[model samples]
Target: TKMLRHGEVHGKPLTSKQKGLFGLLAGGGKPTRLKKKRDRRLESR
Candidate 1:
């Protein structure tokens, strides 16, 4: 029977390009940018 392994289907692995497309299709696409944390001391500057 075919199985999934490490983000792969059957015995074939997903390529970098396909991974991105699949991620979006699976609704797990990465955010465009991460939110940066601001230090409390920096807020006063």
Candidate 2:
């Protein structure tokens, strides 16, 4: 419940690994492999 109730409450983004760990502890399911998507908008010149 901490994940859902307090994870994002700080206005910070949580990494995939953190999400997976939280999910597991919360009895939601297995840890999911998160894919890294390239953000074109953030690409450096």
Candidate 3:
């Protein structure tokens, strides 16, 4: 369900890297700096 929802929102399937990041997040790791920066850019847009 998570993968399906992610695909629906992004309009494409997740790549291995993206899936790995999602796994990291699900496992309670802090968001990486790059991910935080990207999220900031998206929010600014």
- Best candidate per TM-score, number? 3
Could you tell me which 10 consecutive residues in candidate 1 have the lowest summed lDDT?
A: 31-40
Q: Please provide, for model 3 over 1-45, each residue's C-alpha lDDT reduced to its tens digit, 9 standing for 90 to 100.
A: 487346534577787777777777877787778788999999998
Which is superior by TM-score, 1 or 3? 3
Candidates' C-alpha lDDT:
0.55, 0.61, 0.73
Model 2 lDDT per residue over 1-45, tens place: 775656674789677767767777688564334212334335644
> Model 3: runs farther than 4 Å from truth?
4-11, 35-45
Ranking by TM-score: 3, 2, 1
Work out candidate 3's RMSD over C-alphas.
5.9
Candidate 2 backbone clash number: 0
Off by over 4 Å in 2: 2-7, 28-45
Clashing pairs in 3: none
Model 1 vs. true fold: TM: 0.41
